[model samples]
Target: MNADFPFRIVGFDLDGTLLDTSGDLAAAVNHALTSVGRPALSVEEVRPMIGGGARHMLAQGMAATGGCTEGELDVLQRRLLDYYAANIADKTQPFPGCLAALDNLTGRGVRLAVVTNKLEHLAREVLDALHLTSRFDAIIGGDTMGPGRGKPAPDPVLAMVQRCGGGSAAFVGDSVYDVQSAQAAGLPVVACSFGFLQQPVETLGAEAVIDHYDELIPTLVRLGSAA
Candidate 1:
């Protein structure tokens, strides 16, 4: 309802931003660890290890389990992915007020997109399982562009803008990667306070932070107007 809102495209990170996927992601991490004779990790224990991607999350779990060989990690990574794709939505759901917030944005003619470090098929699979795939105007994953150019780099963020038909954009996410990427892309970012903050949320260096999705639109209005 704030007509002065300046952004046209609003991009979001998938895992910790829009959806609370910590439960299922932790299960996949624990499954991979236990198969290699390592102990299982609790969901709360694995919360901070997420966000980068499956391999990064598994690496953290493996490191906690005393580490494993590169070849062993390769096999375990595949195993983790399989299990995660199989049970993608078992414990995953949109964060409280997320759908309503998205509805508000859509009604305001803002284009919505998802740009995640999650692999393409897997991100789409999880979105499909939740029947939420139709919500976004675009979905770009880690592998969608190329290797090593996912986040903390401007490639995918630029791609999000291009794919959304080129307009002033802002990104919403829950991690340093998200902040780093958006800043690199020359866009303002809003961090989610309730997300899987690996460190203190203040450390992310975002323009604004919201404790809940209900605050998102007003936060965006301020961020956009200030820009």
Candidate 2:
């Protein structure tokens, strides 16, 4: 690790933090809803429902569009995932300056990992489509750590450290689950103000907040120095 850089491994949340997947995600959700003759939601309306896994987002979508039974949710979730997998990168792209930020960290020899609540195959497929899968040292998904151990449980965050061969670590994300998971794993976390936030960014309780990826390296440096 570079002596000037305080962290050895940095973990990131994929969907909202690294990529702006709201457009494609919203489309997938609408696909499922429309298949059952339900109303479709706007990207804005579906943005906040992201961060959780697909099932959770679809559940929220169903609730918003007039509710559904458990079995209905089960069926819709499959439809949603199928549609999403096929259209994963249709409108998905890195957040502004995100690639630059990743390059900066990698230049400093900081191993990078992606820990997301999205399903593993789906996450990998999308990253593959964008040709970004090679950039990460580890790509852990909601299913990687098994059931009930995705986020807010410290498992995947801990797995990232282990997969990166262990060192001083930090995390970046846009949700309470991300903050809680990193904190539980005893790592400082930065929150993204431009991501799909379900609540006020300030309320997520991250160590630092960056409004744009342009601010990321400096914020991480500051946090590292403080540590």
For model 2, how does the per-residue alpha-carbon lDDT over 97-198 read when each residue is reduced to its tens digit? Answer: 999999999999999999999999999999999999999999999999999999989999999999999999999999999999999999999999999999
Residue 25, candidate 2: alpha-carbon lDDT? 99
| Leading candidate by lDDT | 2
Q: Write the per-residue lDDT of candidate 1 for residues 39-119, one digit (tens) a residue.
A: 999988899999898899999999988988889889999999999988998999999999999999999989999999999
RMSD of each: 1.2, 0.6
For all predicted structures, in order, the TM-scores are 0.98, 0.99
